[model samples]
Target: MAQVGHESHGLTKLEEGFRYTKGISQIPVKSAMREGAQALESARLEALRGRPEALADLMYGGRMGNDEPGDGYKYRGRGYMQLTGKDNYRSAGEALGLDLVHHPDLAAKPENAARIATWYWQHNVSQNAREDVTKATRAVNGGTNGLADRESRNERWLQTLTPELMEQLAAGRIGRAVEPPAPATPARTAPNAAADGVLKAGEKGPAIETLQKSLHALGYTDGKDRALNPDGHFGASTKEAVQAFQRAHGLKDDGVAGPKTLDALKKAEQTPLLSNPAHPDHAMFKQAVGGLEKLGPQAGFKNHAELERAAATLTFEAKVGGLERIDHVALSTNGTGLFAVQGNLNDPGHHRAHVNKQQAGEQPLEQSTFQLQQDTQQRQKLEAQANPNQTQPPPTRAMG
Candidate 1:
């Protein structure tokens, strides 16, 4: 029942129409098409977008017993389990003693849909459904599409259909039983009640205002150009800012300021900003930020803060001798960068330089102010030498 509810979208949508916008077209293209054949060029996909029949033919034609012209649209998915294709319709019709192939639309009717879905489930997924939801999803969906929703629905159904609840419904005592309210008692508040509680959308309070202020201070902003307003209302902008903060901190990006998210936010608030000028490695940080800004989108960094975090990880490794000190950093446009470092600093004889692939915009380990200036000059010189036509900055003199 849970799987049926999920597949049918709470028993609302039972037919496959293939109606989709340009951006949404990619989803079906990836899910429906075979691997490696799923790479439909964007321009070509856009051309087919908003055209359901054409999309159906493109995706379903030449496969799944859809050899005849318009077979794709004729035998399109229908029913709770989305029984699709000419062969499937024929087989299901035979099993249910209905002429589904001749009357495919009949599969969309509630009673017939339920029958077809149950029959399909019994034949294909019932065995796996007893083991794992993921395996059951794979059996039915050909992939784990909407697996999370399926799992959630399964859990809800399990809770709601308990033996006790079933007995109440069977005895017709569901609405008849009403328990009296308990006598009033003194309320006790926990010390960290606000910190523990979740701050989700549609909520308004000083706690939400504090969260908004913290997000704003952490350099997180709404998707729009405007900054987040600490208005005590958890609106779309506040939720967006919270989601951004969560993403930056590697938390679940659900947009709700839950206990974990609130804890992370508190830690982030206490930690100094990556771009803080007073930091010891501020010069190198500034240079990396400048380079990333100059490269624009090609640097593949969302912001300087992300780059700083990645750099910090590498810096710690180098300091502990887990990795050799970085010699040169090369930024690439493909969301990855090359770090030229020695294979092992412990073995001086092994001068073999290793290339470590790091995310773009990551900097080398922290260096002294003088060393950073020299390294910057050397990097510019190397770039100029490689691309002779490109202008370069003059090399810096060694500090006395």
Candidate 2:
């Protein structure tokens, strides 16, 4: 609350303003310009005095992912924490499942401002702040721009939020507590008020049934991995499933199926399933394959065929032999083999490539004799490169 109050000036200034006088502009411009973060000539700075848009563009363009023209002004500081720049907005939007890139002003909306502020603090400052106001201020402002003011606010807030005050507020003895208003009632109940079609708990109908079905199809289950029943009842299990789905897809886990969450769920449902006729558990295998394909060239696979091969190997190992589940797969830098890292997001294993070597004259995955030989040679080369001194035994195969 202190940090937010300091950043947004008591929640009155959600969006940043740039109507600075020539001399006033120089203060922030010069401070932010240190180390060539922003390059503006003295004449140019003086000329940009009262032009908010022009000043914002000059100061913020070409940095912080503001590649497009007018992006600086469009993505200027907003929200309680004054989230600035294209990248920051986009990131917060992804985390919250809000299209902040196109709808940048959403960050300044009273409903979203606090959420964005909290998200920013959690991701960027919480780890380092640790009861230190200066570190928190620097993390939020990129410098100690309001260190003294923030410290003062923190002290004042600490004094105001005593246990007695909290108890009174909780007991309704005091006036309304200082919190953002409850989200406009879900669209199902308040059609006229809701701009976004939102489905919150206690709203049960076809819309919620559809949402539950989508969540079930996408493999989001309750705490015990029990699939959600498409009973059209927005019960606790359904809400938990929705929240789990949101968490996995980098969306805000508010358990309300809003427009953004609905869209992401639809996209996840529509992802193409991989087809490998030879694999047993073809349905599960295809889903795993689809995930790998979605990872795409970014994970270093050169083409679909390579991804298919790696997926086939991992799926086969998981289903037929030694692995629990196909969790992580990565292609080697030189594209020689796949590195399968076992474990889920919570408990990741070591970062080591475990290659399964085929016995001499043995054929796997219907690979031709020549292809098998080539694979053998590549594996040998990789092993040699990995250990030039032969100090340790050759790399062993571990199923992910």
Candidate 3:
């Protein structure tokens, strides 16, 4: 039942309480009586479920229940967190065993709030904390903060969720932190780098390989799988690292996690603690993905998550002469520049588009950065799709 309710609860904030970028599962204070206390409790890493303070807060914070159906600070931080005013108090309470009108502070107790949160996590939010939180927040707050309005609380609890929360309390940080699983055997690939694109023999994509290599170099590697492969495809191990990185940096657990994801992963390699993972790449990745999202509105998204939806689901199709064309999907992580090919625009297999591909003499890493900058190409392609009748302008600027 708790799991069912959690799935229905919606998204959360990634960076404090700003916007709902995704709709992952969230553990919130369901009873209005717990809202006030839940709000504070949720923001305190020290009182999470496994911690000793959790039960203690339930006793003290749970006592002050209110009367109004939705009155216990519904607007300020109501709903699940007892955020503010009347509506949230009533709604959250109605969902839980308590009635907000009778016991508004149901949301105030850390234990009750944690109980609801745990229920949510066990059922819905836990499926994919990163993505669900991001999606739900988008549904709630819109794009103002790109996170649901509960990131502060989420981040706080997330800090305590280190490997130690799994019922295994170690004496030091190394024991408590969520380290990558040890190798089932020996690591075959040596470490490489993202900036250099120097992956080991088994790797594939430039970006994937780069990330893997960088992760390994930065100590985010398994004792095994040291074999470097550079396919650039984000795989399982990468996903785990990303989750750890998000928690450390306060990002939602969306596995498609990118630059901010990378920065946090890198930092864990460096500092290894609960530090603010919000970085410049986070903003840049947001910008780049934002551009992808725009393509949907101008070009149209089929049924996928729309850019307007905040998940940046961009539905696009490359058609030629009324026949649908299968344009290859390439992320900046796919390689460093545009996939360039010198073919006639009028060629039957292809069309005239700016080509930004292979060049010699430049380091591969520089090329990757150059490629990522080409996200503009996607925006332009979207524009072309939206208004195909617009006359193609001739190149007028001088070459750099």
Candidate 4:
């Protein structure tokens, strides 16, 4: 893995990735004595892992082909073990149930590399032909680059198989590369709300245009307003367009146009619906995350970031685990030199976030501010329930 990363010109962030060199996924370069192969020890492997080059090549080039292109880091050095090039991907994927063609990123991830490394050793590599090992490694580097010549590949393959090296490779330091498990999805939330067909005032933007196109494509509307509702609006015409789409798609007659409505509209339009990443609605992520449930550990993550290279942002302030009710929502925006609040809000996680922040020498943990926010939000909710006409107040956060 290290060799690949070093050779590939991975950035600092990429270098930190476990799938590449400089991370757990890297193959530890060992001492020359152990590199040539004899029964090796675990610690020996650990030490090898630190050196950029272990085998016969650190000084000149590590143990590469006996002829030229001798093993160093150019092609067949780390993780894919000896596999490289297009042919390597094709042959390896055949044995691994992976479509490496589209997902080349899979090779870099640590979990997959470990699984594939072992599988290759057990199933494909053997003692009968040391030469075949060389060819396999050579094929991986560049099928055409070395294979077209044929002569060099043949000579190298004969010397490539060193029993000691085979055993070392078999040690499983390089895990059998395989796809990682997926992340678990949060449960679906309450049904979503959308305006009914015949757009009202307010909702506007390219979104409305998108909706209009969807409605027209699905044959929901035959009018000229098919381009997009102008003047940044989801007007009466938009509402009617949605209704036309809904009825055509066979859905319940609610004025609001939601996901179901959008899908039908997109189908009608015959264009892909837009999914903006900058504003990820928690709803859309539900399905994909759910599918990832069986893949790996998730709860261990406590923040939106990993403080290092992580495949995905795993941290979200956990839902405030505990709550208490209060009669009044209040705030002291001036006291803490920040807008501070007091009242009930699920405040446990808020408390923890503050604690972690302070301990890490960041901003002081400000529970009081969060408390005020929670209070304000609660007050608003209460007013909404008590008198729908009332402008809702902000939520509060308890003091630190």
Query: Using TM-score as the measure, which candidate wins?
Result: 1
Off by over 4 Å in 2: 22-26, 29-50, 128-130, 166-400
Clashing pairs in model 1, backbone N/Cα/C closer than 3 A: none
lDDT of each: 0.62, 0.63, 0.36, 0.36
Residue 203's lDDT within candidate 1 is: 60
lDDT accuracy of residue 237 in candidate 4 = 47
What TM value does model 3 have?
0.22
Candidate RMSDs in Å, in order, are 15.1, 22.3, 20.0, 24.1
Candidate 1: how large is its RMSD? 15.1
lDDT of 4 by residue, 158-209 (tens): 3465554566578753356644546758846522123344333335555566
| Candidate 2, lDDT over the whole model | 0.63
Q: How do all the candidates rank in terms of lDDT, highest first?
A: 2, 1, 4, 3
lDDT of 4 at 355: 19
lDDT of 1 by residue, 142-230 (tens): 78866655775676677569876787789887888656546767656423425548888756668878888887766566643236878
Ranking by TM-score: 1, 2, 3, 4
Clashing pairs for model 2 are none
Error of 4 at 358 (Å): 45
How good is model 2 by TM-score? 0.39
Give the Å shift of residue 139 in candidate 3: 4.1
Model 2 error, position 11 (Å): 1.0
